[model samples]
Target: MANAHMRKKEPDKVRRSLLDRTAKLAVDQGPAAITIQAVATAAGVTKGGLLHHFANKQALLEAVFADLLKQLTDEIDRYMAEDPQPFGRFTRAYVRAAFADHKLGVRSPWAALSVTMVADPGMRRLWSDWLDGHLAAHRATDDTPLLEIVRLAADGVWMADLMGQDRAEPRDMTGLEPQLLALASRPPSA
Candidate 1:
């Protein structure tokens, strides 16, 4: 009975290990390499063990993508908590968190999950829905061009960072942040 109880707790660890292996494979060899056997091998688990945690490749990919989204949302929440502004908190938080993640290194989990998301339509939809929901929450309260511009600029910076383009020339965006924050704080012109 005690052994059964202990076994129940082990699945979560196994699942996490499988997900980490999938992300590493995606980062090293792209999404196509994320087969069940590949992930199981990478994780040092048998194929049957991997399947016990994730029924199939799609399930595994979905789990990884979902985990990524949760991490991003949590990071954004942390950043938003630091800033008291009500109007642009979400966008600002998103920008700050994304840039921070970029600095974590090139093979960040977010980048690996991005590759998987792009390769799988279902994963992409999951990301799109989360993004749309976040934008809707902000747009419902404030519909301003400046806010949109800030969102776009932040997205551009994030994309550039994700693609490692910024490393080529090292364009600094620190000066632009305060300016964008000021614009986000301004009352929308009637």
Candidate 2:
């Protein structure tokens, strides 16, 4: 019984260690640097061990995206539950959180994963489906047109932010939050 318990705990420890190493490597260098051997070395495991958990680079990339989405969703869900904000408020928070990095010229790991997905048609399809669902959900809300505009604007902001086109000094959007909230409260389009 004691041996079995230790054995069970060992895999969990290894799995977490692998994930931590992968995240650190991803943060330090980009997804392209996340080879199985590199992850194993960073995690102090053998390549065989890494492969045991993740069959290949594709699987590893998928896991990374899944983890990232779960984290973002959890934070947004918590905020929505606490405040129940208008659409603009929600958009502001989403943009601020998603593109709030202080460092300019740094390539986003999220974008790196997105590039990886582009190479895989299945993942591309999955993302398209997910976006469609999200858009549908937004359209179903009370302030449809205003929220839609806010959503579209927010996407442009994110694209610029992600693509490094927004080279201007990062302005504090602190005051704009309230304004966005007011705009979001507008009635849906007829």
Q: Which candidate is the best by TM-score?
A: 1
Instruction: Give all TM-scores, in the order shown.
Output: 0.81, 0.71
| Range of the 10 consecutive residues with the lowest summed lDDT in candidate 2 | 96-105
Candidate 2 structure lDDT: 0.61
CA shift at 76, candidate 2, in angstroms? 1.0
lDDT of 1: 0.76
Candidate 2 structure quality by residue, lDDT tens digits, 1-190? 2243344447677877877677667767867798998998887767777788889877776666666666666655555566555544455445444544323225445555655666777667666675566556554453356665665665555555555535576545455445555666665555
Candidate 2, clashing residue pairs?
Answer: none
- Tens digits of per-residue lDDT for model 1, 1-190: 3243345557778889998888888877777788998898787677888888888889998989888888888888898789887877887787677667656656777766665566779988998899988888778544677887887887777666667644667666667666766777787667
**Candidate 1 segments exceeding 4 Å error:** 1-9, 140-142, 165-170
- Looking at candidate 1, what is the lDDT of residue 10? 75
lDDT of 1 at 116: 57
